[model samples]
Target: MGKKETIRKKSPPPTNQPVKDVYPTPPPLPVKAPNNGRKNGSTTTGNNCASTTTKDLWDDLFDGGYRADVTIKTDNGDIIYAHANVLGMASPVLRGMLKRAKGCGEKKPISIHGVHQDAVRVFIRFLYSSCYENEEMKEFVVPLLVLSHAYNVPRLKRVVEVELEHGLLNTENVVDIFQLSLLCNAPRLTLISHRMILKNFKAVVATKGWSSMRNSHPGLEKELLESVIEEENNQKEKIRKSKEQKIYLELFEAMEALVHICRDGCRTIGPHDKDFTQNQAPCKYRACKGLELLVRHFAGCKLRVPGGCIHCKRMWRLLELHSRLCADSKVCRVPLCRNFKEKIRKQSKKDEIKWKLLVKKILRTKRIRGSVSFLVSSNSISS
Candidate 1:
């Protein structure tokens, strides 16, 4: 019998397995954080890197020596290995993506496009441990914000927003930052950027970002223009109201001075019964001296009749205002107080409305000026 030939079935060549790409261990990035004030022997390397005794383990795991379950494919085609558990726990968005990938038969590398790979690397490091470099933050803050928003990482988003607002927000970048803030849904940053743009509108308009925004986002440009015009109108309105308020306050002070002169005597003028001694001290009211001079002029001026002299007309208007505000016109010491009240009552509807509005304004101004106590006492004296 011929020796039975043993046909050895060669085992299938070893299944070709692609080599996993490993990123070099990045030095710990220095994160800006308040110091504990206690001296520690551990050297600070990079932002958020473990500075404690177990730092080596953290570095090994993050630098890809330990078991990394998922790979991140950056826009530049760099492969970064990461642990699914850490990323999933940090972000629900990432958890869902990881789950979706696992559910599929093939685990394709998660692609993060439209950003620099270094920014992606920094982002992944933050997921593993919360830390980052200051210079990198300055250079890649906007990209980080975009990534944070896309990945639904609120903490990183807030950090980037704060860094931009505090350090980078300026006339040069305000317009650009404002647009990004809206896209990222960062309200505080939006408000700050809006205010900065408004405050330096001319400078902001001159920036390249503003020009680009105007061309690309005509709606935003129109909205900002409307806001600026509205802000200008508001400022002008405030100024006009301020001037009107001053006039009303002056009228109120004049009324008080008139009452003081009629009821009690000022330094030079008063009712017939009150003493006008030359040695009396000056009145406390600010308008006393001025009103005393006006009364002296009205008494002596040959054109004392109505519609005659401007000074007399001014005095007549003052007396009319006093009559409108007076509680008791019958026995009021002010000359023509009753006669003015009678004329006011017989005034045309237009004149009546005009005087009433003036009276209302004076009273409102008095209340706002905190002179209620003084007016109350004056009313009591009249009664």
Candidate 2:
């Protein structure tokens, strides 16, 4: 004994039918015209009720009843009824087809292939009414996108792209959608799908769709791999720039602290006029306390030669920077400021350019930090 095949009923001529078909590849059945016995161009509601809005009129037209002028045949021979003018106005590609078919005095059925009949029904529904059920959209979005693209329906294409970008896109189907986006020339969808692939590379590459695409489309596979590498390199570059920015910001803060200490001093270090023995309140500058310790170290370190000690070399560099930045180098309280100014004149052109570049970076960093107030005014370099 064999199980009997289920014969599903066709969609009735009505407004807003629930989209519940499971899209099984049912065997082709005999085609029959809908039996709504009404004359063409008549949309009488029979109850004498008025349609309150344009949407209601469009809905009535989409219901087709007996007014549809043409039929659309789907991949599995399921027939959908629609108006010629509606389809013509909504899509230029369809208009062209309809124009070429004008010689056939009677309208012939327009055949749409490569997708399920249920999807074709939804596509036709949207063309007439600019409306669709959520369930139908969820089930037939990809097919709808393809139909929209093929038929040159930009509005429907845009809507489908948004739907895919916001809700339908996932790692399991992203690779397929990415390829579709390229085929359809949807730049936004392409960008979004590409980002999803890059962000979830392992999961996306593991999907069956990606596996199929890899086997059949080696060029695309190579392109995606190159993009992944480029994305990684871009991330590395961002990290490097962030680290460099941090160093420049620190140097900027250190420069500010150096000027503050030289002019007003911290709790334990200052010029001849400033007191060094008073138990002053904690320094307001965040870097001042650290710079005070380094100053004390620089004053007492025995290995103060150019290459002798790292700490002294750091102090020497700071002092040299201050000299380059100071307008009144001769009277600047910072030790070696005058000496560095004199010695800078004898430096090689390469060394001078390097120091000038460093100085520019520090000044640029300071300018970027517009909120930081200066602590000293005398002889500071004009930026």
Candidate 3:
């Protein structure tokens, strides 16, 4: 009876579990870089891929000939196909026009005023390529510059500005460009134009553009005149500084020459022709303001004295020069020992450092002293 009852009582059914995935989708096979191997995995593809995808969806649409629901027409009746998204991304002005205009679609030609077909062509190309330049591209610059400003394409405007800087600005076109720059609110272009005009003011002023500007825009002409005057003032100041620097260098050379001359007694630089041949007396020439005084002082002065001789330096330098020229250093018999090899070496080494330091000293001296004299003593020649 118990075994029959066990058979009658049924066991509870087993719970079922869903199957787990054998392998997570093998993480997208690691991307392969180019054969160059220099590029890492992170290096993005080409500009085409970027322009066609994230940064330039319009580029992809334009290339694929899709979603291009509008037509842009130039003044020459030349037609250009474009996507609204692209034009909108490039220019707020275009975006605003598209938003405001009615029935402006593929059927209706959106006339872009005052732009030539060639310029419109380049402008469209730029929106897709993000760049433009070359010899051929230069001709289109003015038109493109105008179009970029009108359309509010700042990036295109910036590129054009940099190109103008590299361009060969000349008298024929600089005035036109300057006026255009003012009209377009391009400060960099304006600045460059001003520089070109100032550099070649005579040539630039002679041009038709300058005359046109002068007659039509006198305010700008006045500004140009003011700039020219300002430039002349700047140039004059530069010349003055240059002259001052030259004088300073000459003064330094004179000082060096003077010290050398006094260090070595000059034979001709004395009042002692016979050294008082009859009486060994101080010569009367020592009391005069002439070559005699210069000669006597230079022939007898002690150069190694701690306190230096400043007043007689120039005269001494002149005498030393005469001595050097007269003495053939190879057989120099002068008491100055002009031929002494060690003396030459010592002078060279000593003067080398002094020469370099002179420039700095000159600058300091110029700053402190109001001005240095270029005038020399009338008796310098006699001395």
Candidate 4:
């Protein structure tokens, strides 16, 4: 009876009761993540964590919103940018320079704003840590030279000058380096370099003479010699036309005086002169002796027999003797004869004008003889 009463009391559940679906809600539609791809307040948490993880990294990289360390990566390699602080530097200017340097990558990997990689690296290291010294400076010498010229780095240029001074003193590299010094407009460097170059005058004259001749045009050569002469002449000239004319006259007089002095001192002495002793004073009285000595001492000039006239009796005597001794010998064949003959031929050619005139006279005589022979043969045929 109690169970039946409980059943009667349990009426139908309320028709408007909420139904519980088996499928769960779709996670609030994922909140459609923000365009920044971050959850709200997530970055704040991350920022805090990152700051804690790497303290002072940003501070070290940037000072008061200005970056001091510039990172540059190129195809060749990585380069760090730095500069010297002579005085207070402007942040904007520094930033501009950095930007310009970075923009240089458009043309090539190793160039920054037309500055070469070697130069840029040297400049960067110099600016950043002042690390160039001794051996390191030597490694950077060539690049620094280019950089110094490009950027007008006076101090760096001086360093290059010092290196060149040391290098030019070497006998092996003197001539080429002297030319380079002159081309670069280093006057002091040229003086040292010239000394080295002049040490090998004969070698330079024999091997490099053509190039030197080409470099000095007729006008320039004349002007140079004239200037030397003018320097020797200290006499004042009458002012007939202008100061320029007087200067010219003075220069001419100086040049004449110099020539006279040179002729008296150098040209008068013979090879067998009493004062001319190779051991005592080899170059004392010879015109070309000084040049020869200079060339041999520094330029490693080969010892060659002195050239002489082929038509001279001495030369003919030597040839006759050689021919008599070696004519029938197979060992002294075409090559050996040709070598000796060539020496004679070159000596003959030294007086090319005289040889040519002699040859022409012989040809004319031969033509006259040929005509006379023809006439005699005609008369004989007729008889």
Candidate 4, residues 34-90, lDDT tens digits: the string is 222211112133233433113233323232324334444433565543331310142
> Rank order by lDDT, top first?
1, 2, 3, 4
Give the residue spans of candidate 4 off by over 4 A: 1-78, 83-120, 128-131, 167-176, 202-383
Model 2: CA > 4 A from native:
1-57, 100-107, 276-282, 371-383
- Candidate 1 clash pair list: 28-45, 28-46, 29-46, 29-47, 30-46, 30-47, 31-47, 48-131
Order of models, best TM-score first: 2, 1, 3, 4
User: Could you tell me how far off, in angstroms, the CA of residue 73 lies in candidate 3 after the best superposition?
Assistant: 3.0
Question: Measured by TM-score, how close is model 4 to the native structure?
Answer: 0.29
Global Cα lDDT for candidate 3: 0.61
Candidate 1: Cα lDDT at 229: 94
Instruction: Mark the 10 consecutive residues where model 4 has the least summed lDDT.
Output: 374-383
Q: Candidate 2: how large is its RMSD?
A: 17.7
Candidate 1 per-residue lDDT, tens place, 68-112, comes to 778888877899988888888988888888877742333435778
- Listed per candidate, the RMSD to the true structure in angstroms reads 19.7, 17.7, 17.4, 31.8
* TM agreement with the true structure for every prediction: 0.76, 0.77, 0.56, 0.29
Model 2 pairs in collision: none
Model 4 gets an lDDT of 0.41
Worst 10 residues of 1 by lDDT: 35-44
Tens digits of per-residue lDDT, candidate 3, 285-324, equal 2222244355456557776232366535745444444333
